[model samples]
Target: MDHRFEIFLACAPGLEAALASEAKGMGFGPLRPMAGGIAFDGTWRDVWRANLVLRGPARVLARIGGFPAVHLAQLDKRARRFAWGDVLRADQPVRVEATSLRSRIYHEGAIRGRIERAITEELGSPVADDGVRLLVRIEENLVSFSIDTSGGPLHRRGFKQAVGKAPMRETLAALFLRECGYRGTEPVLDPMCGSGTFVIEAAEIACGLAPGRARKFDFERLSGFDPQAWAQMKADAAPHPCDLRFYGSDRDAGAVRMATANAERAGVDHLARFECRSATAIERPDGPAGLVMINPPYGERIGKPGPLYGLHRDVGAALMERFRGWRVGVITTEAGLARATGLPFLPAGRPVAHGSLRVRLYQTGPL
Candidate 1:
């Protein structure tokens, strides 16, 4: 009998609706938007595809159990009584992370400690900081439990060995690509590409490659996991050459070098082109019109906010002069900086958390 799996794609705040739409467009059934994630139901095949094909998910969680509890004793009783042996191994190290909101049991540390003691003392398993399974929780007078199935988050693609200063995250880069309507068919240009994450991801997406293909997942180590099935699935999802569709340039030679090295590690060096050039030199290749997405320096990450406005204005000037007919997407937290660009803003979605600051994606026409 196939088990019922509750899959969640954890996302930045205010972006759950966009991700839900993307999932639905991809034929993912019964997608429900939650606080900071989108929940769906699927088998292991769906899990594999989500980690592979999803562009906006920060991490994926598999819900294990949810039950009501009014007091700490009830919490301990129900948590211990839940089927812990079914998912976690006696020898596997594990950690418990808990969050509480409007709950009778308001102490987070106390909750974590009790749950940890229950699993350790009763189950004969010890808490491990590294190289072990993880138990996550959301307690609001009721408890919801999940086993982290993605291991060390999905962004650690095991390919980015080198990164430039203020590098963009792989997960965020993928989401930005999707926001710009990048189908991976035409060339993608990241004029201020830091570490070439966008270019490498675009190449992989176009070639129909799985993002987690080169990495290990925690589910593989879980009890009753089918090794043969996983092997077959991975083998079937291997990368193949389809088209050359990625390019990135940075004025910083160090960033260019880092991007080049990262692309090589990702095994898509042949599918991308990297150079140490300014955004003014960006040009489209001989193909159908494509997308140009950029995340320029915002005040939060770089210099004083005073100079950032002009920098944004300069960036806008460059894009307008250079990229006349291409779809463009820009991410930033400062409204002033965005206005300085003078680009006609079309809101793709709401603000998303990029680190601590809330940011939004501003898009413009095919010109």
Candidate 2:
């Protein structure tokens, strides 16, 4: 049954426009950008396609219902009215998380308690902490419940078993790559390649690999979901080849090792080379110039931005000196630090929330 499903796409703030554009390109109809996410109407299969293809969205949520309720009794009654058994198994565990925005349920803990109580009392199932089989999101007095079709956030592509400090998220990495217009036709480089997210994402894109092919999803546990159909979908979507190669380098040996391990696990080790080298020692790949994207460290937590200024300066100078005719994109938290790069960055784009800090993207081409 191709039932009506609401898909919520979580994204970095200020990137909703870009994410919406990408959804349009992918033939998703009429994307409406909301606070913290975007909503689109589609079927369960569309959710599968989204998790497989969308690079900008952090997580694609299927919003099942948004019924309004003013009190706990009403909420429980409404929750019990829905067809939870159709999606959740009786023996498995599930988790429900709720948030209140201008609603009577002010305390999140209290709201969680009510939902848990209702589910267990009405549905006769105990919640499991570790082996959580389902995830539901209740928002703004509207209980927009959903099952996590993609297991453990799509960014945990299962390939990155190892990583460096301050490594960029794979989802954000792919989004930045798209923003930089990286089609993977030309060689791509990440000079300060902590855990090699950028280069690895580029390699996967170039080779036409499905990012979610290696992992399992929560939808696989649902009652109506077809395992054979999912397997067939994955089998139909295998990797293909392209001309461009991916490369990354880092000054820290530990980071290079992690990058190597991550690339190897992703099954694209043959298409990438990770080396231990500083930004100053960077050189163009064997082929023609392509995109150069960097996510440099910002010492915001230590409350010191001086050293980062010099690092950005050094990166900018090295790019100017060696990477002529190359397109460059840099993501950083501090505005002054990005200016220190001294590249002809067009007016800065809106800052997007990255974990705890807000980061902005700056792009420029070598003159």
Candidate 3:
């Protein structure tokens, strides 16, 4: 059998273009950008490679099989006939989740129960409350089934355990870096480096390290998984020499320590350095000009707007006075806060949903 399946690369909102670009560069075929992600078609091996190598996507989902079912009885009948044995092991546990939109089968609970019973009865697999998740989407009377190839989101690289207030996810940080024109050649510095996400990601890119190298994925537990092939694929990762170093500084001493330890666990401590310093006190490192990216505190998560304006003003003053010829990328929720920075910012990107609020990246060519 071909075993080629439709794959969806999930990412944060407003980052579909960047994720699509990364997927294209990695040689994924026939890419199409949708509302929240990118869709493509490939075999099981492509799924493994995407989870292992792609840096920007939040997760990888494989559309295993689907059929038209307008009612619960039809859905149950169709679900039983799905080729579950090809992908899921009978001895393993699985969970089924469903969502309905503008379709006749609008009862999600009934949909979940029917599919769950069908899989259990047909495949002889035990149903668990929490394990490998099978997603079912019913829209306009058409039902589709997909499996989460990534158990947890891809952002959990399994390295950093400690996080500061309002930590930026690794996947989001990677996309933001790409948006700022970072190609792993130049140095990157995060002034408010909560958990050292940006710096460590940049260093890993500079050293040519696979983002999923030190982590485990849900695909390993699926059927037809070849351990030897996966071992060879992971072993092919060769770390290159990085001439430039990445830097991160935070005012909190504990955050600095956590960032350092996280970098050590990521195996890029040699290329990244962490220190404790406020944003206004930060100085440019002794090297060629690179990118300065910061995910500072905003009103949504941190203090009120009044004090934050001064903080933004101070950060702008420090950068404008000391760091010349360097590019800047600031992520914030309020345009007023970004305006407080007084730096000559070019057009801002689309607002992305981050937790409960929307944020955007304000960029500048050179300061």
lDDT, each prediction: 0.79, 0.78, 0.91
Winning model by TM-score? 3
- The sequence of per-residue lDDT tens digits that candidate 1 reaches over residues 1-367 is 1576798899877777767767887678698889998998887667766776676788878877778887888888887887788777787778788888888888889888888988887777788776454554545577888877777878889899898667677887777777777766877888998889888988888887777888887777565677788888778777667766688899899999888999888888888889888776666667776788888888887667888787778877887887778888888887778889888878645888877777788888787
Off by over 4 Å in 1: 25-27, 131-133, 136-140
Best of the candidates, lDDT: 3
The ten-residue window of minimal lDDT in model 3 covers 123-132
In the range 295-341, model 3's lDDT, one tens digit per residue, is 99998887787899999999999999989999999999999999999
Q: Which ten residues in a row have the lowest lDDT in candidate 1?
A: 131-140
Output the lDDT of residue 174, model 1.
Answer: 78
Q: Write the per-residue lDDT of candidate 2 for residues 1-367, one digit (tens) a residue.
A: 3997778888887877777777887788677889877888998888888887776777777766557877777877777777777666666667766667777656767767776776677666677774443444445666566666665777888898887676789988877777777766777899989888999999998887888888877766655777777778788778787767788999989999999999999888998898998887898777788889888888863336777788788889988888898889989887888889889897777788877888889988654
Cα lDDT over the full model 2: 0.78
Model 1's TM-score against the true structure: 0.92
Which runs of model 3 end up more than 4 angstroms from their true locations? none
- Please tell me which model should have the higher TM-score, number 1 or number 3: 3
